[model samples]
Target: MNVILITACPSGMATTFLGARRLEQAAKRLGWQVSVEMHGELEAVTPVSAEAIAAAELVVVAAERVPEPQRFDGKRLFRAPIHQALPDPDAFLERAAREAATFDAASANAGAPATATPAPQAAGGNGQRRIVAVTACPTGVAHTFMAAEALAQAGKAMGHAIHVETQGSVGAQNALTADDIAAADVVVLACDIEVDDTRFAGKPIYRTSTGAALKQPKQTLETALVDAQVESSGAPQGGSAGAGGGARKSVKERGLYKHLLTGVSFMLPMVVAGGLCIALSFVFGIKAFEQEGTLAAALMQIGGGTAFKLMVPVLAGYIAYSIADRPGIAPGMIGGMLASTLGAGFIGGILAGFLAGYSASAVTRYVKLPASVESLKPILIIPLLASLFTGLVMIYVVGTPVAAILAGLTQFLNNMGSTNAVLLGLLLGAMMCFDMGGPVNKAAYTFGVGLLSTETYMPMAAIMAAGMVPPIAMGIATLLARGKFSQPEREAGKASFVLGLCFITEGAIPFAAKDPLRVIPLAMIGGAVTGALSMWFGIKLMAPHGGLFVLLIPNAVNMALLYLVAIAAGSLVTGVGYALLKRGESELPAVADAGSGAVAREQRTG
Candidate 1:
């Protein structure tokens, strides 16, 4: 069989490539000729030639939105959402082969391409709702597109007209127009970072995290339908109002963790860029940057002097922005600058952000003005009052104590013995793997990142090392005991390995979701082992991200070979342990076996 596979996602990051790889692997296993075209945030990678498309027996589109569907007119087409192909690509392929229909450009409306235009009402029309959604994450990589796809799939399944705007690393795609927003019955913001919601005024809005939307799309939508509150025209952009005219707090609004995570997310790019530049400066020798008027010195100035200088301010500003929207930014940034000047560091910056955010929010809420003067609240009144309050409090009340604490903490960490270092590594490692990419993982990550501004590198090294273990270990486990996993799991393990190498811990999510009891403990154990070993070896990392890839930059990682060994040691422990303990499909009871009949059938057919 000749198969032309088309895979795409909103971000064209992890999911796009994962789906393409899975399907290609499945096709190869079935002894079929496969040509893959992948669409992502960037240009399509090695698109299938027209000759190949013409000769293909089947066109399988595993995408959020099929681009240029007219190209497949008159061909047999099998279209499924990317989510469907992710976990069970082999089964997905088998189903495609069996159920593919001839594509007619005119009749199918060119694969019903995703557009700002609203989808036609479902047949029988009753209970239909028009939904507009925006999905964003701090990294703007994996979760953003995943949540968008999940919501799109769920909305389709529930007979709702839905349009999703993805705010990712590449910025917003499939953006919602004013008409789209106006037509929507409700707006869903599945974002880990703060998103501007002013455009959604007068519409019912429901907010959720990308994880929730990805895990339980239908339930999220159902909840949104029931609990979504109307955005009051008179209220501030980020604030919300219920039907009864009372303020409604969302997950982002109520949780200090979310606000902190938002800050961390916004701060990450700065850390990575600054850290890498500093690493690069070291390539010219550690003392090279001390000599001015050179590239190395310039790199240092850019990385350490500018980027690092702004890092705390960006973190603080965004944290406040997450809390109180635009009104909180000025005060937050001013407070962060004060924190840096006072030598209070990231901890002080965090305090400043919260204080400014709450102060601004309080002012926005309580300091009502006449209609003629209301325009001045956010710009003039809020910033002036909030900044004054935050700056004064930070300098007078909080600065000295926080600076002392940070200095003590830094001194202790810098002088800690191997035993203490190992203990700290173990704790951070466990936290990194605990929930993969959830709050616990982000907490550990944020801690490590915070230390970077203080020139403390070992904790960051351990955090990353621990984070890389779970996915790589899962990959190793599948290789060690293939029979213990399904075909999809095996395929996913290959991708997981690659993702792990790049330090994407979320690659282990599918494995963990399937068997958390086994996967999570094993991963945590592996992470702890890696973290301990890295610390024991006295490894130091300059960059906060890029996993093993960062090692390519000279001096980015000290003791690189030992770091690899530490990672390998942890991966081996997890892989070997899980392989030994995991149960094979054949070991399942009758009930489980019955439940797996469809997979068995698909395997036989393949």
Candidate 2:
């Protein structure tokens, strides 16, 4: 028999390839010819050719989501969660062969091309609702696709005609068209990050997180149907388009956090470029750049003089944009530039961004104009008035006090004693591991990044070191106590190790989500240890991001050997702790089941 297997995951880091390998081994044992296609965050690896797909007797998809399902239209298809395949591939394959059904393109409209018409509702009569949704997460990986798949499955089972557009790291797939939006009875946005809802104006919209959608998809759908409200055509109620007209009060706070993160995301590239350039200049001796008309001076000019100068403005501008859309950009950037010139730094820039965004949104909503001149509101009137207001406030009110505060803070950090430094590091480290990549982690990261503007590098070093500990520790724990983790988790640990080396904290999320009680505390202890060590050793990092690879660049990190030791020590602590604490998979079934359910609930609440 000829079999075509497709596998995918959010980041394309681990599960996709692992599932393919297991399925291939199982297929080979059964003496079947198999072709595998793996989809990750970017693109497909060794995608199945049309000829190969045509010749296959069965197409099995083990993924959080199937990328471009239309490619296999009319084929006999079998779908299962990627985890199901990892535990027992032989049994999974047998079920695929026995239960695969002919896939009709029209039945699963979510993955249909833009031009495709809506699928007919399931056998139930007129009670079926037409729903459209978009799912996204901060990393644009795991939760994004999981939520999309869950909603699709739930909608199908409940006799609803639903289509989901996934906004993953690779960009939007199966995007919603004008026709789809117009026809939908309600729209659901399952996102942890801000998304453009301009096109969704006038539609009944509901906002939620990916975790909530994944855990209680049926309930989420019901809630949306009942509580979703029609979005207004004007500026959003609380400076966020995603916060629809009838959104709950808590949404306003969530919107603020998302807007701040949006700014940080835009500012990161500039920080990395500028920091690396400064580091490169230090290679010629710390004072080399002081001598003008040289390569070191030129590098410093590009990195410090230009990129660093623009970072605050870009951050403030994007934050405003996330809150009030395009009109807020000019005011926010202008305010940010003023903050920089006045020495108020990143803190002032953040304040300026919020002020500008809310002012712009308020102006847009309240200002009235004739029909002929209404177009001028977004293009001319809004920018001019908002910029004036934001600029005046920054210069006359906010800037001087903020500058003084920043100066004092910088002085304190520069002269801090070792004990104080270690305490600061420990606090930052614990915060980083508290929620993986959630708001607390981002808050710690944003604090470190902000300090870069003040020429303080120690905190940045501590933050990165602490952040790297979790995934690396998880990987080590799996190795030390292999019997504690399931097959899927062991494979995930291997991927987590690689991701940790790259400083992606989300790598340990799978382990944490499954066993937070044991994993989180152990990881936090390791992070704290690494952070304290980094501070005590007086290690300094010039770059804001990059993991172990930062050590390769000359002068990128000071006290590099000690830095590595700090990271290794932390990983060892967490690894050994978790390995001893974790329960073996062979433990009593009832206990395991209860533990699993509790962990699932915790993940959902979080």
Candidate 3:
């Protein structure tokens, strides 16, 4: 088959040529006729002739930004990311040939040129500043999405483009893109689990804990693009705190986690892919409760079975890429398989692969072995160790506890209204208001997700509503009376309202942190009231995270009206009380914002 290929990475960078060169090399090995064109930055070599694109049996585009399929009009186009080809020429040709042959077979039949488009290229692309977040917690549910929601709100409020990639029990949602990284001015990582930031190389990035971002979003904003490399001047290799390691100071170099994180970033879909598919399988296919028909069977075949099967390999493959630089794929795949067998899904598989790679690395480092032993690293040493460790830990420790907790939660929820309904709501709601996005907030979230197993989502929904209102109401009040907050604080209010609507209670952190005395109680009062009310009126929510945005997704929120009311009432009270308590306009910032000063206290005379 005759084939013509064009390669172009996001930056229109060198990878474009590399991909083309790789494909050409592959075709050469197979003794097949092929032509390659290069775009982006080609130093001396020119692209393949346009005539080739016109005459070829198939057109292959290894482009980071896949041009709209419409561009290739009648050409048989097979497009993939430039990464697929570069540095591995032979494999590229083989894959290209396979795709071309498939297209040829199609053309032989009653086929048109070939259907071109793949899933969406980019929807919700143009956000402020293009921030990419990997939100997570060990539990993979409540705290994960809550923190994700908080960070997204924070990003939007800061007027920066943003894309939040959630890493939770429900799996990843809104995966980040290379374009997202390239276009971003800043990266705010509000997470406990590791988030890969290597893609943000050369871009300013603020790595902060979820709690910190939620509680001090404005301060977080300060650290975002402007402060990741905090000092404006030739900043010290490391910041004053020296929080990062030695390798970290060099913006040019990345460490173990950096590489691993790269793969984790890509592996996000596996978690989601597997989980959502399995959920659909159970929902539509299995009919665990009763007999299901073809619809359920079909859903499981597409959603559950295949996607679930692909989970670990994808996770491992990406992580290996992070490590050993290029050659980690084989080891990563083997390790990933091992991880899956241990019941360690996507996130766990990543960890297993990393361990496998490093251990194989150690064997290479210490052992005076021959070249033959080297290949064994991937097929033997790496996979064996990673799989064993992952399996043992998952089954005996990680998986057991998780299963027990989930089981307990499910059982409890099933029994919730059966015994202590009102009391539970009050407790959960109070927790929601307790510290906004702190550990207290997470506890409430976990309870709700846990109850999800029992087919109960009300406790979580109420808690979320209660936790969301106080900050927004306070923001409204402050906006209404600019006299009640400092200049900076007043500006922050703009962000707070947005965060509040999104159910990010931590948006009011500055106010609460600065004036725990008056602000916290008012916020708490509103939050508690909101939560209690929501619980009294049952509300169901589907998406694990996001404030109101989650409301937009299919079957996202049940009893939306009541949920809105609960949040509104709480916000209103909080706003009114906060506005009234604030003293002089000048005093507000000193009282409510951490970055601002204390109210100039009047000196008492002797």
Candidate 2's TM-score reads 0.70
lDDT of 1 by residue, 76-169 (tens): 9988888899888889999999999998867666335322122222212458889999998777777788779979999999989999999987
Checking candidate 2 for backbone clashes, the offending pairs are: none
> Candidate 3: misplaced stretches above 4 Å?
1-372, 393-405, 418-456, 479-483, 486-495, 513-516, 536-538, 549-555, 586-606
Give the lDDT of residue 255 in candidate 2.
68
**Model 3 lDDT-worst window of ten:** 597-606
**On residues 26-134, what C-alpha lDDT tens digit does candidate 3 reach at each position?**
7667765666555441122233455655667777778743333433566666666777676676776667556742233333322322122111112223434455666
Candidate 1 vs candidate 3: the lDDT winner is 1
Tens-place lDDT per residue, model 2, 182-217, is 888888998877677767776777887776676558
Question: For candidate 1, which ten residues in a row score worst on lDDT?
Answer: 597-606
Q: Cα lDDT for residue 157, model 3?
A: 78
Instruction: Point to the candidate with the largest TM-score.
Output: 1
Q: Give the candidates in order of lDDT, highest first.
A: 1, 2, 3
Check candidate 1 and list the clashing pairs.
12-40
Worst 10 residues of 2 by lDDT: 114-123
